[model samples]
Target: MASPLKVVILGGGTSGWMCAAALSAILKPGTPSSILDLRLIESADIGTVGVGEATLPHIKEFNDFLGINEAEFMRKTKATFKLGIEFRDWGQVGNSYIHPFGTFGQTLAGVEFQHYWTRAQALGEAASIEDYSYAIQAARGQKFDFPSEDKESIKSTFSYAYHFDAGLYAAFLRDFAEARGLKRTEGKVETVALKPDSGDIASLTLASGEVIEGDLFIDCSGFRGLLIEDHLHAGWEDWSRWLPCDRALAVPSERTDDFPSYTRSTALSAGWQWRIPLQHRTGNGYVYSSAFISDDDAQKALLANLDGAALMDPKPLRFKAGRRKKSWYKNCLTIGLSSGFLEPLESTSIYLVQIAVQTLIALFPSSKPGEPIDDKLADEFNRLIDIEYERVRDFLILHYHANTRTDSALWDYVRHMNVPDSLTHKIEQFKRRGYVKKYRDGLFSPPSWLAVFIGQGVVPHGYDRMADTMDDATVIEKLADMRVRIRANVDAMPDHADFVRDYCFVPPAKVMAEVSK
Candidate 1:
């Protein structure tokens, strides 16, 4: 019988537990029983940022991959279903739009649907392009339902994610991982020891003076990257220029009687604020630049927006929005905030963690170190992750850069700032022809771009020429049919708050009252 290799994971936040969950699910009953001696170490003394309360739909795949029941998962996490995000006052004050997860309509005549809609709008025969989106209708109507039938029907055309309590989610994953044979150790790592010859992490000594050894180390340590950056000397990539918000104040409030199934990102003077509704409570936060906005003002802004009674005091958090130069270096690999961080504008933190763990599993090395694991393999893994990060980064920047709100210095700067060439080209293409071209296996597809671009007031100059093949009246009628179908379906959905209470409500599974010392 073969022995299981020792797997050591540092830190116990969402990233750590996600890694544990994935590894446990795959390696628990490998070919032979007990083939993975997985151990996770984290300190109760350390605090997690705990602000990524919203998620992308990709999380469904992760949970499914782990055999998690959706209702049960949501119940445990106090999660609320999310169809998309509502960007309020982004293009200008009092103007809003939704960035949904589904398509605009079927691509038209070998040309995109958005083009035909754009042409109709130019011809004064159409409403906003958003009118054709089923998700937009459902979100606006505050409805929730799973597509039990034809997904192509406007009766079931939208995709969804979740707004959950982060701490509860970590605890849920921890339970899942532990149940699958992963060993967890509670301690503070005092020092990270490197191999004398290679300078690669060989072991970590705990505050109790006990040493834990492993051939490979997974760093889930938050911002500090204790092992990956602090000890390993991995460099940091500063993306503060492109993403300026650095400080945030997060607080939870009593659950509102009416819970919408969508997250809200309201444009603020220096940054933006997020409103995430969970079954148990409402999560609100003001993410902003300290240089431009005072901490007191940030706190005040967060407090002022509460729709319910305060559950707790505002928690302050600091961050730099960027990734490490090399997420994988030597024998240690960094995931989560250790790897990099983009603002949670689109609720991508969990997805990033999911991607990293999946990538690590796919690129899991041979038991013997320095025998087969090489830079080429690492490079390939990092390149995919790098591109994914860059893509998400560009998407986030578009939310800020494409806005027409230039009333404040913050907005003015972001409005006139020079964005990445990649983003610029995407905008140019979309505006020129109402066309969106996605990257090779990209995270955001054409519809995702269309939602944001059109929402942010990027009106196209012309529709696709081929779209002209469709008569204007015919196009308008088809679009109207889409709207009618969507409205009927949305009106039939169960109330979001009611659906959650019946299906996925958890009554305070667990709460961390304080940071352990």
Candidate 2:
């Protein structure tokens, strides 16, 4: 048999551990498996940004693929179920709406439900599109139920993710990986030694003067890209001009009343504020533009609206929104924030990392590229990631550009700014006919587009002409019945707080002066 490949991953935050955990679970530990040897290096001194306590709906598949138990993972990570996201004051100030996980109403009488809803809406005989979405109804009441395996059930219309402590999540995955024979090195990387002839990394020198060698390298070094960028010199494409908000001040607080089943993004003057509720605590942060808001003011704004008492003062982080020119180069593959950061606006951060890993596994080479890393493979990978970035970028920009918040300079600038042709086309297509374009392979689906576009007041000019084939009165009656059915499904779900208590709960911390023992 051919020699097993040695894969050394740099850094040990969420990305490193996730990669380790995944590879370990897939390959036999200490068995000289075919083309697999996983190792991760990290330092306790270097702090990790755990602000991404929220996640998208795809996380379930990732966990499931690894055979991880959802309840155990949630309990260990202090996680709460996430139905979707709620946009507050995004379309217009004082206006709010939810972008739920699942689809809206089912097709009605040979026409999409939205079309009939729109036709009735055009005649003042229908309610907003939210009425037809079971997921949206459930989210509104702060409720949750496990999505059904049976596709025919209305519960199948509901999908959910998780809201957890990012730090604890890293810890959880670290255990999973270690138990599977992935070596965990606790040290800072001092230098990346390269092969003078091939221009590929040969070994990494730890701060302790120990050098660990590998056949291939995985760069999980956060935004610094210690191996991919610092060593290999992969260039970056800065998108701050298009997405100006560059700083984030995050803080965790005691769990407040009424744990929300969805993350809340409330628009602000210079940028926006996020409120993420976990089973243990609430995560608060302000993603703001340095040009418009000072760090001092940003921190103040982050503290002002927190529902619970502050546990720790805000810790700030700065990042540019963009991707590396090449994610795979020579013998190094960069994943997570090291490869790119598209902002966490849509909770795509963790999902991005997951995709990168899955892609690496699919494209895993048998030998360290006997000649050179396949340019075609690298090119295709970059292309796909670029689409991932741009598509999500546009969605985030939409929240800014399509808003009516005129209270600040930042809003004024973004309100009239030009967007990419692709996003522009999408918005135009939706506005003209309520038609949403799904990517050949990308994250958001049609219903996601409808949720945000319709929730934010981008109603269609007209519905499918075929929708008129149905009697107007019948269409109205059917829509009414659908709303009733959706409401009944949502009303049967358990309360969000009760679900956490019974399923998985993490108790808050307490400080005392004496030891019971």
lDDT of 2: 0.84
Q: lDDT of candidate 1 vs native?
A: 0.84
Which whole-number lDDT from 0 to 100 does residue 339 have in model 2? 91
For each candidate, give its TM-score against the true structure: 0.95, 0.96
Candidate 1: regions farther than 4 A off: 29-35, 149-151, 369-372, 507-517
lDDT on C-alpha atoms for all candidate structures: 0.84, 0.84
Q: Tens digit of lDDT per residue, candidate 2, span 1-517?
A: 6656778998888888888888888774457654677778898998888789899988889899989898889888878989888988888789888888988888766666777777888889998788888878888899988888999877788799999888888988998888878888899988888998999888999999999988779998899999888889999988776788999999987777868789999988888888998766788899999999999988898899888899888998999988898888888988899999877878999998998888887777655533456667777777787777778888877777787777889988887888878889999988887778768988888888888888777889977888889897888888888888888888888998999889976555421111111
Q: Alpha-carbon error at 374 in model 2, in Å?
A: 3.2
Per-residue CA lDDT of candidate 1, range 1-517, in tens?
6566677999998899999999999989333666567899999998888878999989999999999999988876778899999999998999899998777766655777887788888788878777788778778888888865775566556688988878878999999998888888999999888888888787899999989988778999899999998999889999888899999889988877777879999988889889998776789999898879999988888888889888889999899889998888888889999999899998888999998888988888755533324666678778888988999999999998887775888888888889999999989988788778866755888888888888888888986788888887888888787777767777888988778778866555442222121
- What is the clash tally of candidate 1? 0
TM-score of 1: 0.95
